[model samples]
Target: MDLEVGDKVSLIIGTETHLGFTVLIDESFEGLLYRNEIFEELKENQRIAGYVKNIREDGKIDVSLQPQGFRNAIELDTEKVIEAIYDHDGFLALTDKSDPEDIKKELRMSKKAFKRAIGSLYKQKQIVIGEEGLTLVKE
Candidate 1:
């Protein structure tokens, strides 16, 4: 694909970003995501994912790998989810999950993606859904 600044890409295991010990994208390109730029706390080898935000003249390409589309794109889900889980009880109903829906209304993703994130949070046991609403399982 024509990789340029502000393009989204995925990185699998055993890749290098050329800049450092990053899990590279396309197994060749170097991603440009910094810790401060990420809304989520990136763990070591946690798989840096974002968009390509720059391409330098030195033949090194810069990628964001952020799940969010671009700078102009709506903010990502994980951050919002974390915020909602912390602000609310973490029991957002499929029908009453307002904060996540605020994101959805802007992002235009299928419901599947939204629910998948909830499933991920559930799997991580970070949050639990109940009749009371979504509640944070951990701090």
Candidate 2:
């Protein structure tokens, strides 16, 4: 197979099964996109970008919508949270203590990712964590 782990590819969303969503990768190979890894809404036949996560010995491929690796994940999530904060008038009703589901519903990201982004923002002094939630630090 020409595709290797971390290679960016095109994906066509397929059927949802007990495991996850089946996908056609690069319109050639079949791959599985796990439910837990997916953060956004997807529909059958929808085309999207993905990265090859793994290739099993049995020839099955695993795909992910987001690029893998610590730095990539943190950067993407951090940018997403910053944009959401700006869109919400510089205030967000989310904190480290917020429910995971609520964080996902509000930001379409996992709570772990949300926390990392917020933690980074706090360290950068770009935002403030308060009793009610988070607020963008005005310059």
Candidate 3:
């Protein structure tokens, strides 16, 4: 296989399964996009960018919609959170104490990622965390 772990590839959504969605990678390889790793809705025959997450010993490929590694994930997630805040009139009703499910529903990301992004924003003075949630700090 020409694909290696972390390789970016084009994916064509195939079928939905109990575990996740089956996809065709670069129109040649079969891969699985696990449900837990998915954050957005996907439809059959839809094409999207994906990263090679793993290649099992048995030849099954695991793919992800997001890039691998903490740096990449953090940057992307941070931007997403920032954008969400902007979209919501600079106030996001999500705090550290917010329910994980609520955060996931609102942000389509894990609570941990939300926390990290909020923390970064706080450090940069880009946002303020309060009893009401996250408020974008106006410059």
Candidate 4:
């Protein structure tokens, strides 16, 4: 398939499996996108951009919605959190202590990713993490 790890590819969303959604990669390869890795709702026949996470020796492929590196993922997740906060009048009721399902439902992100993004935002002094929620730091 000439595909390598981290290669960008197109995916046609397929049926849901216990593990994840099956996808048609580039309309040629069959790959699986794990449920835990997904942050948004996907429907059958949905088309989206994806990256090749792995090509198993058994020929099964694994794909990811976010680009495979910490830098790329953190940046995107941070932006999403920022936007959500802004949309909520500069505060979002989510914190590191929030339930993972709550974070996923609210932000479509895993708690780990949410924590990393919030950590980045906190380090940048862009947001304040309080017991109530996250507040955008005003200049």
Q: In every candidate, how many clashes are there?
A: 20, 0, 0, 0
Ranked by TM-score from best down, the candidates are 2, 4, 3, 1
lDDT of 4 by residue, 45-132 (tens): 9999999999999999999998898999999999999999999999999999999999999998899999999999999999999998
Please name the candidate that would achieve the greatest TM-score relative to the true structure: 2
Candidate 1 lDDT, 1-139, residue by residue in tens: 4676665677543333344335467666644454333333345556545676667778665555344453243235545566665555554444235464453553334344556555666777877766645677755
User: Would you list the clashing residue pairs of candidate 3?
Assistant: none
Clashing pairs in 2: none
Q: What is the C-alpha local distance difference test score of candidate 3?
A: 0.92
Score candidate 1 by TM-score against the native. Answer: 0.41
Winner by lDDT: 4
Q: Tell me the lDDT of model 4 at 53.
A: 94
User: Predictions ranked by lDDT, top down?
Assistant: 4, 2, 3, 1
lDDT of 3 by residue, 1-139 (tens): 8889989999999999999999999999999999988877899999999999999999999999888888888889889989999999999999999998988899988888889888888998999999979999898
lDDT of 2 by residue, 29-134 (tens): 9999999888889999999999999999999999999888888888999999899989999998899999999998989899999999999989999999998888
lDDT of each: 0.53, 0.93, 0.92, 0.95
Of the candidates numbered 2 and 4, which has the greater lDDT value? 4
Candidate 4: stretches off by over 4 Å: none
Better of 1 and 4 by TM-score: 4
* Error of model 3, residue 103, in angstroms: 1.9
